[model samples]
Target chain A: MKKFLSALGGVILLASSSYAVNKENTGCGLGYMIFKEQEGLVYELLAVTTNGTFGNQTFGITFGTLECKKPEKIANRKLEIFVAENMDELAQDIARGNGIYLETLADLMNIPEEERPQFFSKLQKNFDKIFSSENVTSADIIDAIVSL
Target chain B: MVLLHFKDGKSLIDDPSFFLSPEGKKNPYKELQATIRAINRNPYLRCKFPARAFFIEKFLKINLPKVKCPELDKFLEEIKGEKISLIFADYYINSPASMFGHTFLRIYDREKNVYSFIVNYAAQVNDTNALIYAFKGLFGFYKGYYYISPYYQKIKEYVGIEGRDLWEYELKVDREMLLLLKLHLWELKDKYSHYYFFHKNCSSEILYLLGILKPNNSPHVRTPWVIPIDTIRAVLDKNLVRKINYYPSLLTQLRYLSKHLKDDDVEKVINWAFDKSELPKNGSAFLYEFAAQYVKFLYYSKDIDRRKYIKKYLYALKLRSKGGKINYSIKPEGYPHVSHRSQRFSITYGFNKVTQYMDVSYRPAYHDLLDPPQGYKKNGEIVFSEISLRFLPKLHRFTIQDWKILRIISLEPMYSFYRPISWKVDFGFHEFLNDRGEKRKFLSITSGFGFSIGEKITSFSLGEIKVMHNFDGEMPIAVGLRIGLLKQGKIFSFISSISSGKYLKEFNEKYFFDYSLRFAFHINRSLSVRFKTNYQLVGNKASFEPSVSALIYF
Candidate 1:
């Protein structure tokens, strides 16, 4: 029993190290999440007019910050950002059963090209299941896709 | 010297304090010596100005010094820039400042393509008042600074929100060149120059950054104004670009995806977006998809409220998910590099019923409605500082025909799914025939708002108000209606308009009718032949004029 427990702890250690690697490599990790949520009307307007941010505060994707702890969660975090950022187009692409955003999403999920058609069809057929409610967030849709 | 951006024997750096020596701003030799001495005294200056340090070591063939800059090292390591691309965001016509488009740099890491960062040099603008913004931008009132942000942020702002397409030109740059670029970007951090809208703008600054790598091949702004696309042409002319990629906007993608949908299907999609009807059960994925895109466009254009937009969009998506995948692709045309030159010069010889004349005209900037439509917004016109002179050969005298300071026309065609207002404004001085049928020069300001319909051949009707002041001390205000048909094509294009107005002149109301027709045959990208005619009936007098002209765009 002790040997089995030791083996389990070693597996956990290996998993955690992999998670740390994922955190470091995903260069634009948590900064996007933080910056996007706090973006106000004036900042957006400034971004539109000047193609530059207002004031001096740097926002969006800084050097190094790892808020995500687990490898799976880090992947989910990225998928969530992509979905949320491209929510409207992704929905249309899914409904139409094809689009660049859909292709990109398939790429993000590591869905091979041979499997993408089936996957897109599956999503289209189960659209109601994925987008179960009007208030469905990117996280919820991602969860639906995973479950499917 | 290239890194310092010395032009005409003077440094481009507007700030005096950036120079280490007293005369460093004006004298490159003094600046180079001072930079060397400063690096010798304090090795950290090499880190502060690594680009300059690289240049100094390379040119003088001597190693001055070395210093451990943990911060600089950390920055370089974190960026891991392996490649550089010049990104051009297509023009956003709604904003006066961005009408010419925008350009920036994308520094790409070897493996982290998604995490690539963009370096943008733009005027740090805080004022929302457009007139004030224009005044400041034109006269170098705003200070331009460089800011680095994630690539996705810009993609979201330009492509998703503003519906502006992006063209990526992967530059032929190596690792060493990338290092020089990063170092120069570091040097420019928190530094600023007085931003001039015309010459010392974003495109020019980006070109200066590129000049560090290929100093001799780098293009310079010879014209008084630096157009964004012209900068792209300059770079392309030197064969600096290796590959080109297009990222279409959401609207563009939608247009391409729905191109094959039937008329009834389009109507249904529109109906679904307005919540007037439910989507068909087990509808084709394309239908549902198009419906969702339509709703999203409405939301993005602010035609629909947020609450309605969200509800309708999600519903359509949910319905669309019940169908099979449909295949479609978006291939956009008319890239900026292929567009005709912005400045134009033309000389024409023509004859009316009265006499023959030679006309010489020059436009300093931008497209007119009759200009070649390639790489420009269709049915849209922005002409600035255009002047024409007429020489009557029989009379042997030159006269100012017209001097148009600014004229803007946006004729967006209306559809059942989309309805945008068409508007135009003209501020200019033109020679007009008075009631006595004699030429009288007048300064006129005319503005109109209306609706347009159709594609390829568009028809529009506008309610216009014209205020004119002639040299004879007569100021007349006219309320009129103008209708026109415009056909814009690659090889052939034409526009014919007729206007009728009631003018309040000398405490009396008089009706005036004016008609104009113009046809242009494009010989090539740069040359075109045009036939133009005008007829005017004021009070009981009428005059007609016809002319033929050849235009060369450069």
Candidate 2:
């Protein structure tokens, strides 16, 4: 009898643990937080579900906008990165971003007179990654700094 | 003597005179006849004709031959008396022979006891141009008078004539003519050439004469060359390339090059002039002004695109004074410092009246951090210490093209690497748990940054992690993120980063990871509530135990 009770307790603990994880609700909800980074604005989805919800959502929140007031973090992060490296590189990165954009615009202009629309569409597909939620990288946003 | 006719209509005695036989050969008849002939030949010598005869009769005692005689003595004496009377007819005309000329003669007039003499430009006769030549020589002598005034004056007085009188009367007339000549020469010199003295090539004495300007130290009279803008440019362009000492005046010429030449050319000249060892040393002000002016010109010309560089340059020049005042008059209100690190905290909300229901959100959390890696401890006395930074306005999304450009620029990581990147840094006593599972109060500093990657994602970074040690121990390295919680339509976000300091002789050490979550409501901007829970990780730690706080945003 003792052994059976111990086994039952063990199963209950295991079930509860799993249930607790599921109840935590890892899926992001309808809200988003916006905050300023080095380059510009960035958003992140916030999870509103509490411990009682299931954790069916796998991917992190897909925020529509990132507007948050957390300056301490931004400043601290700047100090860290800048402390270990050369600040000039950061400036160069901004300049390079602007240069590339201009070059892409130039390329789009080079299309033959009749085939311009197609060229523009291709250009948009190739170069518009910085604005979309699906394809932008950290590098794209960091160097977006057009001016100090 | 040759027979000569006179204007007097008195036939000059060509035949021997038979009159005055009381005195044998006493008449000086032959000599008197010859004198009359000489006077007839030269009119200027006519005044001396009688005097010549008297001197011959009185001194040489030579009588004229009977063939040329004609009561010569008495006739010559009478002519002499008439000449003397005419000469003194002005005012006795008494000038010492020694002072005037030695060419004087005496005539015996037993009844009058007088001597008569004819004065000519005797000493002055040596010069062919007479008065003019004599005056010019005197003027030249006066040129030396300025140098030896007293000596020249003594010489003049010793000669019994006032210098001014001599200059005014005897010399002035001719000197005026010479003055006109000199004026003509001066105008010609100015209009045509600097080579006025070129023909003579200036004698050593002439140079010495001009050297009188030496004591006065007027370079205008001395130096062979005067530096000008074009000359400076030529010299600098040819050789001067670095830190040459230069006079303030000469350096003034450098600006023309700077103004007219290309930027690179100006830089080259400046660099060159700076290099020569023989350059003058008073150019600091010149160089400073030159650089300032040139840079300002470049700024206006758009050669340099950033106004910040101009501002920085001006600041370095100390032309501007800096204040902590910032442009916070816009929608957002915050003061930013030129800091390597700072901790900032703010809450802002804006809602659209056009929308039916207000959508509100609140981000409230306490953070603190350190910079320059000073230490892992936020000494309790100071609550917290941190270095922070913040961008203006806010972070936002970018298009795909922008993203690719950023990628090419390779700087998105810099922006994306901030955690909770917004506007806040905090230093204060924070709630934490000690290693023994007991509630403990410790001083802590926290900072973070957020970087946008596309429209939805961001790379987050946390800045400083320092925990004050009440006991003997070092802080631990703790960093992580927690985002899986929600309550009442609000989401909670949290990130914790900590550093474990290396152990030193009297301190035990541990790693730390701190975390916090904000239960922010998505209500309209007018009102939002944020409930937050804070926790710190102490090596292999688990989630935070329940302890929460609330913040209201207006």
Best by lDDT: 1
Report every candidate's CA lDDT: 0.73, 0.24
Task: Compute the lDDT of residue A46 as modeled in candidate 2.
Answer: 10
Q: Model 1 segments beyond 4 Å from truth?
A: A1-72, A75-148, B68-70, B77-81, B109-115, B322-324, B351-355, B506-508
Give the range of the ten consecutive residues with the poorest summed lDDT in model 1 chain B.
B108-117
Using Cα atoms with residue i matched to residue i, what is each candidate's TM-score against the true structure? Answer: 0.84, 0.19
Q: What is the interface RMSD of each candidate, in Å?
A: 25.0, 54.2
Error of 2 at B39 (Å): 99
Best by TM-score: 1
Q: What does DockQ come to for candidate 2? A: 0.00
Q: Which ten residues in a row have the lowest lDDT in candidate 1 chain A?
A: A15-24
Write one digit per residue (lDDT tens) for candidate 1, span A1-98. Answer: 34323433332232121101112222222112223222232223223223323122331233122222223333454465466555555666666677
Which candidate achieves the best DockQ against the true structure?
1
